[model samples]
Target: MKRQIVLFFALAMFSACNKSTKSNATQQPTLADYRVGEKWVWKYKGVTTQGEIRSEGEDTREIVSVDGELGMTIGTDTIPVADMVKPDESETPKYDWPLEVGKKWKFENSWTSQDGTKGTQSQDVEVLSFQEETVEAGTFMAYKIQYKGTISNSRGYSADTDEVWWYAPEVKNFIKLTQTQEDFFYEEELIEYSKPQ
Candidate 1:
């Protein structure tokens, strides 16, 4: 009887810990998850099937205090972290909340690029699996999300595109991304991440 009781208690403790871990990955991140001075840097390169290197560079983003508001650098702009994590109002969003493996959804967006080229995107997004993915920064438990679909533009051009993103909930960001569109291949991997102690 004593042995059985001890085993039962051990199982209960394990079950509780499992639930706590699973919940950590499912929920969307909020501004509360970020802190000023946290930084992330990634190295990216894009190439074509014909062996032409289109773009290559490293991108860095840091959380900073902007007039008392928490903002993050995105390219040349600093946007409120609050806005970045706000409840995505899009009918078809880049990320579906409460992420879970095997979950699927459609994502669509229309935008004008920096050069004023207007384009539209439509993709079927799926959370393929959750596993440990290693990058230059380090290994972390992450979700493998896939986006497959087509992109078309006002210039009457269209192409099929597929992308996979490894999002690490612990980092509150994607650790790596690979995108394939027609003859072009692009990928970015996190090289460094830091947070103020």
Candidate 2:
């Protein structure tokens, strides 16, 4: 009777261990779990090419799908494809593709004026590479990403710039962004973010 009881107890312990292992295995991280529909309020701080320092701009964007389709608004202006200023046949937004490692995307962004006129300005970005890292807060996991890309904003003007982006995820959106372009470096943080009821 004693031997039989010991065997039964050992079997119960083994069953419990197996169940715990399976639960952990099913919790593996996936790209889709964290990189979709992230809204961010971004501010810009950098020097202009004309040697003037400016420190104000707000940017918001939503990745509508995992296939790289995005809706973005910068400073109350939406990017239009119909009227491209200084139409460059080769400028795109970096990360225009899905937010997966080893993936690439480009965006052709143009701006229009409030008066129903097209601004002679647009930006093209190309994503070269992407990487993710972890940061520390009080009791939360912070993810930071880096995007290397090239940009050209020429609208009958000689504004040529190349930049790299460093972004870190906030609670519900992008709270911080850094841009290093040519001879300019700028960083911005979220001042306000809200969802309409």
Candidate 3:
């Protein structure tokens, strides 16, 4: 009777271990739960190698539902509208520009600072590539996504750039945006956020 009892306990322990292992094995990180309808704000700060410090105070971003269309906003402005994606219409693009590989979105306006600096600023975002990988950020699990493209400013100059985006599951936000252009680098962090009201 003691032997039978020991055998039963051993089988129970084995079953419990198997159940726990399967539970862990079936759990996987999924991006589907994250929605594009929410907007994110990135506050940028950079330090030059020459010891010069540059900073953009703070930026705001929002996601807008335009005429039943879905789109993103950056810094108190809307894409294709702040840039006027479609001119000669209702003051804004008639349709929301799709974000995808090989798709091109252009902003033909110049960028000027309040401090009297002027530059012909335009961003032609072509989704060159995108892929997801697993990364560890402290105690959080992060998905490292790389976005490669070119951004051209004034002087008819263009720079190939890549942005490393770390999406943390625990925070439900993009933790970092690392941009590199022609040996120059900048990084932005999500300091604050709010749901759309």
Best by TM-score: 1
Candidate 2 vs candidate 3: the TM-score winner is: 3
lDDT of 3 by residue, 1-197 (tens): 11221122221111110111222221111223223455455566555556555544454555566675544464354442222222223222111122233434443334443444444423333434323433222333444445455555443656675655554434444555676666566666666555543
Give TM per candidate: 0.87, 0.38, 0.40
Query: When superposed on Cα atoms, how far off is each prediction in RMSD?
Result: 13.6, 20.3, 20.2
- So what's the TM-score on candidate 1? 0.87
Q: Which stretches of candidate 3 lie over 4 Å from their true place?
A: 1-39, 65-71, 79-141, 146-162, 168-173
For model 2, how does the per-residue alpha-carbon lDDT over 12-81 read when each residue is reduced to its tens digit?
Answer: 1111111112222111112332333444454555665676675555545432332353332333443321
State residue 21's C-alpha deviation in candidate 3, in Å: 21
Worst 10 residues of 2 by lDDT: 11-20
Ranking by lDDT: 1, 3, 2
